[model samples]
Target: MLPPRWRLAATSVVVVGALGVAALGWWYADGRAAGPLDSVIDDRLISRGEGYEHLLWPLADLGSPPALVLGMVILVVAAVRTHRRPAIVLAALGPPLASLVTELALKPLVGRTHFGGLSLPSGHATSITAQVTVYLLAFAAVGLPRRALLRRALIVAAPLVVLGVSGAMVSLERHYATDTVAGAMVGASVVCALALALDAWNRARSARAARVPLSGQAGRG
Candidate 1:
């Protein structure tokens, strides 16, 4: 069974993180500080690639169009497995929508760019994080059953994928560390916010359905 506080706690964290990232965006908006912070981040990440640039490139592309399509496919498969209709729909639409907001809305609002693209929140990080958030929410919905090997594997692999993608984005200097953090926060916040809203919707429907049966029983009485 899912914990009663899980959604609430997760949603709360998402709110806090999003706000923090937004504050960071304001601080760095329009390339404020002249990228001093980003330069420091770059310096820290520069040598961490360890001559693994080629390998990291593919992993980093997990946030690209092809990888986003793959993530949607995984979500479709997971949605097929789950029972909730709202969740099924959410699994279908949430991640890509989050990615869009990250790229279209958040990026422009922050007004930070890297190499000709708006890049305050790394689009790649946002995409990957949104996908990961969906899987994590799905795992929670399933209650971490011992028999669910595939879900369990996803649980283990999700963070690693995020780490690899985020690391690659930073190591390659595609985005600063702050951008990755902000992107991640945006992705997680959007997904969790949608999930919580839908969960409330599902609960209300269930409650109404239950009341209908009780009201019918009362009429008969």
Candidate 2:
């Protein structure tokens, strides 16, 4: 069962981490720092960033229509499984929702460009996170009962795929460092929150059941 406080704590931590990463990105937006670490990030992301753009462009090319449809299909499939419908739905759509709201609506209206604009949040990263989170949660909801260790391993590994794909996009300049970090926060926060909330609800319901008598005794002698 979910511990409400811990769910809250996890959300809080993700927020804090995103903010920290954003600060670093902002500090280096102008590329002012000089050191081995800066050099490393720049070389991996900034320097060779453009070359890697081709890798993600194909995906971006699918655009909103196809992506949204595909996302919905996946969400539906995950939702139909066992007792994890809510978590799966939230995990599946969280990133895409963030991305769409930010990129299609917020960014244009706010008149922000990818470089200097409030593009600190990345839609691509969010989408990837949502997909990965959904897969992990769905796997957990269905398979954990059968094989605990393997399920745990998959849960651990799934996020890495999300991070790796999103990181590559960031490195390729498809998104600013801040944007990718924000996406990660959105995806992780929503999935964790939903899962915890469901668990807590179930626990509360079970506790209530345990407290109730199986048969009424009002007329007993």
Q: Which candidate should be chosen as best, given TM-score against the real structure?
A: 1
Error of 1 at 37 (Å): 4.6
Backbone clash pairs for candidate 1 read: none
lDDT (C-alpha, whole model) for all candidates: 0.80, 0.56
Error of 2 at 85 (Å): 4.3
TM-score list, all predictions: 0.90, 0.62
Error of 2 at 153 (Å): 6.9
In angstroms, give how far residue 179 of model 1 lies from its true place: 0.6
Give the worst 10-residue stretch by lDDT in candidate 1: 138-147
Candidate 1 lDDT by residue in tens digits, 21-117: 8797898788733366667767767787869898989989999878998988978786777665766767788788888888788889989877777
* Model 1: lDDT of residue 211: 100
- Write one digit per residue (lDDT tens) for candidate 2, span 122-192: 56655666565555454454454357877778778776766666667556555555556655665565555
**Model 2's lDDT to the true fold?**
0.56
Worst 10 residues of 2 by lDDT: 30-39
